[model samples]
Target chain A: MNNHVFRPLYLALAIVALVFLARYLLVPKDFGAHERGYMYGWHRKGNENEWKAVTVKYKTSAYCKECHDDKVAGISSSSHRFIACENCHGPALGHPEDPMKLNVDTRRELCLRCHAFLPYPSSGRSAIRGIDPEVHYPGKQCSMCHNPHNPRIPTSRS
Target chain B: MNRREFLKNSITVIAGLAVPLSALEFINPKELLADKPGGEKVRWIFLVDTQKCVGCGLCVMACKAENELPYDADVSRTWVERYVVTRDGNTLIDSPKEGRDGYTSQKITMGDGTSRNVRPEDIEKAFFVPKLCNQCENPACVQVCPLGATYQTQDGVVLVDRKMCMGCGYCIMACPYAARFFHPVYRTAEKCTFCYHRITKGMKTACVDACSFDARRIGNLRDPNDPVTKTIMSGRIGVLREEYGTKPQVYYLGLSREVK
Candidate 1:
């Protein structure tokens, strides 16, 4: 062909090369249309590892059983067997090392979450024993009269 | 050949090559192109017993503590709503502080000026329904994310890529359940992940562990011995917004007709 055809072809090839080079530089190395789908699957493979590496803040009661078998056994035998120790004591992710102690939430509001009477017969909440907070010891703390570990047995003040 | 005919044929060949080459550049050849997103070894499912929920906000508090969210912030990853139906067939709904504080009063203030006390005798029914991210099989949040910041894991949990997210609100608006919210601190779109960090370590989600009433449970569908899986297989279950067809993984037991 003459120089006329060759000129246009060379210009097109140069533009294509420029676009490809820009894309290589702009797009992240880890970016991909993953196995999920082409339309919505764009993601960085490194993100999965980041998410998996996130620190877990809450530990189940099983973790507490290792050291505090007495408290674990006490709760397991009581009506509060299902309750995890961390629920009332706060998250024990960094216990005995950093803080050395867990704060026990003895607030009346904490206990009232389950004990407050709603009178909803349809709801299974009524199945659990509830007391009328208004009439049942207005200002006194529940822990003063009742031991949380074994709620059935009232705490005997020494 | 004529210059025009030669030019047209050459352009066609170049265009065909360009399309596939660009596509190949974006798609990694080494990655397995599976028909499904996750493997068959694990499929996580969440079950909520609405009957057992007592409007206790422990789960909300636990989620905040576990996720390191601002405790005083209005937005939360999970919340509980109270629904009260009167004998007159009027439905009333309220979620005071997202039920972060348990419902202290039986009285609900009217839209006007007055407050009506929902006594057991006057009210036909009252119940609490906890709400959280559905972690849908076909997630709308993932579909609408412009940057693909939101994605579902192989085990069926949906997570946000905080580094990838550019604080765009597209996924927040696209969510049918209003499960996603802008993080007050990070300023990125955030939602529930079913405690992916804890779950992968063989521990319960913070919310599930906080629920002393046995209101929430998570299970793997692949495990025959999983209690939550057994309950799902044998019990009557329901999901919210079935019309949306998001195929939400969270199932509700004893779901009332009034709940949305």
Candidate 2:
């Protein structure tokens, strides 16, 4: 019942009341709208405009067909129809406008990426004809025997 | 005590109780904004056909390129782990450059400072296991995050709210898969988002698109027509570290017992 003891306790209670009042006014009504659990609105403070939106960089193969109809037609009808041009050619960042010739990787290793036979059990989805790069053509580049865009050998080019 | 003093004490106690009780009522906001009224809730699932993966490392490179993560061991968003078990009870595990560079048959130095040449024929069995955030339905990262910076979407994708994250590193420690990491540049805890940006826009993830062997696929588990749905229902699928009880959305087709 001492006045001195009650003074500091009253001030502490008043400060706590003010803090709650400030939180009530400041926190968004739908602070934890997207989340579920006890600490839902823990991120509501100081995160109003926080999402970092990214632009799409790796576009679909359909994007390439718009400009190069001839190449698209060639690839579409060939044995390599499922393969996207960018897969072999890399990302098409700056193309016809910049007039930069995309590096046509003619290395045998490029073709062997998919065609090299692995000893593991195939899932039947990836049971495409694979060859040992060493025995198939000693030092010959894959492009020398098979066209990259069409991928069929000269015997099956038609 | 006098009646006047007794009444004053009762008033003080009533006021103290009312203040905190009223404050608790204001804490939880009402559901003013309803999430799209009748939109179907999407349940995403990622499938990995381990047999189809030829250790090509294209998916690893594609994930790095798409996320714009630096080409560093500690910073990779996703990586491929090659497990080579030899006939003589020797198991070799390596993920050079986080498997960003395709693996080659070469001499690998062991922990004992001894070198061994690994040839294709000498090994009893070898397989490539690609690893990324499991995006668990019951994600520990989401649960342990001190700040609600990490959350799982209704569609089952776990994401990090970069701005909200306090870089506490608690979520990184909580994750059983070792998927989450403190990003060096952003200084925020970062992990695989299941390509949430692309998946929401009806596009396959960068890894799925880049894989030529159909090694990886993602689809709506609710849609019966999706081929991936059939693969999930029928295939002998297994998840990584199911004992942790995370209930990961990602499933592997030919998961061997050796893979952790």
Candidate 3:
């Protein structure tokens, strides 16, 4: 082969070699090891652990059941059995330790969220007794009249 | 051989050899890790019962608290939408504050460019639909991510790598469900992970646990005995935006055509 043909071949070979070198240096080691798809499953496996390690702020009612057995027992038999303790009270991740207290959400909106009458007859919400905030004791707090632990029974204010 | 013929043959050989060689180098078989312990695989699926949802906004609040998202912010990892259909055959949908404060009003915008409180008599039907990440099997967000920041886990949850996400907003635009959002603090792309941190620990997702009604649930498809799996298999459930072919894992029971 003449110098022209060999020179072009050498140049092409050099370009290919450099491209491979760049890919080796730039591409992550774990890429495409377990991932399947054009570009979907490809990710750093370590990132999965990073997400798994995240601290959960909300605790289940079972956590509350440990300390407040009476309160939990009262709720379990009531209409609010499905509601978690942390839902009404603030997140109890560090309660009784660092904060030593979980603030009881006394905002009227908190009670009214499920209590306020929405005229959705087709919804299961209609099953729950709903009240019109305007006509039904407009300024009074719900806790003053109804005990949340067992809403079926009314609690008189002291 | 002629110079032209020789050059063509050389190009073909090089092209074929380069691709396969690089692919072999990129995939190291020995380093691949098992997806889960005990070699057991899990296929996570979500189920939402619209019939049971009352738009109470408890799930929304729980999601915010559990994820440590801003309390007063308008953004949420999950939210409830209210759909109201009037007597005039006009459908009105409103989710004020993303149903975070619960729906107190029936105020809806009319088709004729007017917004007003909808009287109870004027409305024919209304319901609440909770929205969250669908965690698609063929995710468009994953394909559009330039840095491979968004990925699907072995259990079918799609999570964003905040460290890798450069806040490009590509994934947010790519998501047909409008699931992706910019985190207020991290400023990175964020979406529901099926509460991976909680679910992997054998606990219910925060929203699911917070629900007073049995509205939201998570099930593993790999397990036949799973109650959520049984409901998904036997119940008349449907997914959102099926035409997009994203294969959304979130199943909705009593899904009506009125829901967009």
Q: Each candidate's lDDT (Cα)?
A: 0.81, 0.71, 0.83
lDDT for position B203 in model 1: 78
Greater TM-score among 1 and 2 belongs to 1
> All models, DockQ values?
0.41, 0.18, 0.54
Here, model 1's chain A TM-score works out at 0.83
lDDT of 3 by residue, A49-109 (tens): 8888989888888888889998888788888787889878888888779579888998777
Residue-level lDDT tens digits of model 1 in B20-91:
654333211112112243455567788999988887788998999898899999888999988889888989
Give the poorly placed runs of model 1, Cα more than 4 Å off.
A1-22, A156-158, B1-38, B109-116
Better of 1 and 2 by lDDT: 1
Model 2 alpha-carbon drift over 4 Å, by segment: A21-30, A33-35, A39-52, A77-80, A93-146, A152-158, B1-40, B72-74, B106-115
Check candidate 2 and list the clashing pairs: none
* Candidate 3 or 1, higher DockQ: 3
What would the DockQ be for model 3?
0.54
Error of 1 at A60 (Å): 1.1
Please provide, for model 2 over A1-158, each residue's C-alpha lDDT reduced to its tens digit, 9 standing for 90 to 100: 98999999999999999999998886565556454445332344234223224545566677778887788898887768876676667666556554376666677776665676655433332365677766787677877657777666553322
Candidate order by decreasing lDDT: 3, 1, 2
Clashes of each: 0, 0, 0
Candidate 3, which CAPRI tier?
medium
* Chain B TM (all candidates): 0.82, 0.81, 0.82
